[model samples]
Target: MEQERDFTELSMMSKTRWNDNELRYFQHALSQLLPYVNPEGLTILHEINKEMQNRD
Candidate 1:
């Protein structure tokens, strides 16, 4: 199986800006994978959730 890259690092290194839908998609996807993610990935998911909450 292909190894999964760290989502947080990928986000930090990317220059592309995320739209609302894209962010929602990522949040949903990450939430579904939370159970399998490492501690850092979990932290990233929480950070994403917090940002989403602040936007609301």
Candidate 2:
């Protein structure tokens, strides 16, 4: 269960810094996650890493 959440959360993070090419990949990856997560929830999870990093 924890591992699943970690993997899902990792997918969310990948979207944060995506460029054009990366965005395509991010979207592709995220499509797989959408069935399990909503856009608003994903946005919160997505920003977690970035927000943590900025604090350092």
Candidate 3:
């Protein structure tokens, strides 16, 4: 399988620019990636989760 790229870039982005659906999609994708992601990916996941929470 091809190696996944670093998720740290996602952290640099403004999640606010993403629509709710997009955020949800990323959230799901990140969840699936959780098992294989590195520490930075975990941070990206947390950032997405926080963004989602802020929306609610």
Candidate 4:
């Protein structure tokens, strides 16, 4: 869980640094990769998505 959270935070930071097109590509890659992740990781990703949405 800790590793997953760390990864999510890192990914979020990277995403924030991206321009619109780069962010879209990042999100697309993340969506494709998510199916292979564990449930807990998925949950963390979902939470992160929610936070991002709230920020917007």
- Highest lDDT: give the candidate number: 3
- Residue 15 lDDT in model 4? 38
Give me candidate 1's TM-score against the actual structure.
Answer: 0.65
Candidate 4 differs from the real structure by a C-alpha RMSD in angstroms, to one decimal, of: 8.2
- Candidate 2 RMSD to the correct structure: 9.3
lDDT per residue as tens, model 3, 16-47: 75567667877899799889989977876787
Candidate 2 residue pairs in clash (backbone atoms < 3 Å): none
Tens digits of per-residue lDDT for model 4, 1-56: 22223344455564344344444444565678896978966765565565566557
Angstrom error at residue 56, model 4: 0.6
Q: What TM-score would every model get versus the actual structure?
A: 0.65, 0.34, 0.70, 0.46
Q: Give the TM-score of candidate 3.
A: 0.70
Model 3: which residue pairs collide?
none
Point out where model 2 deviates above 4 Å. 1-18, 41-56
Q: Give the Cα error of residue 5 in candidate 3, in Å.
A: 17
Scored against the true structure, residue 44 in model 2 reaches a CA lDDT of 52
* Ranking 2 against 3 by lDDT, winner: 3
lDDT of 3 at 23: 71
Give the C-alpha miss distance for residue 22 in model 4, angstroms. Answer: 13
Candidate 3 at residue 55, lDDT?
Answer: 93
Q: What CA root-mean-square deviation does each model show from the true structure?
A: 6.8, 9.3, 6.8, 8.2
User: Lowest summed-lDDT stretch of 10 residues in model 1?
Assistant: 13-22
Kindly indicate the candidate among 2 and 4 with the higher TM-score. Answer: 4
How much lDDT does candidate 1 score? 0.67
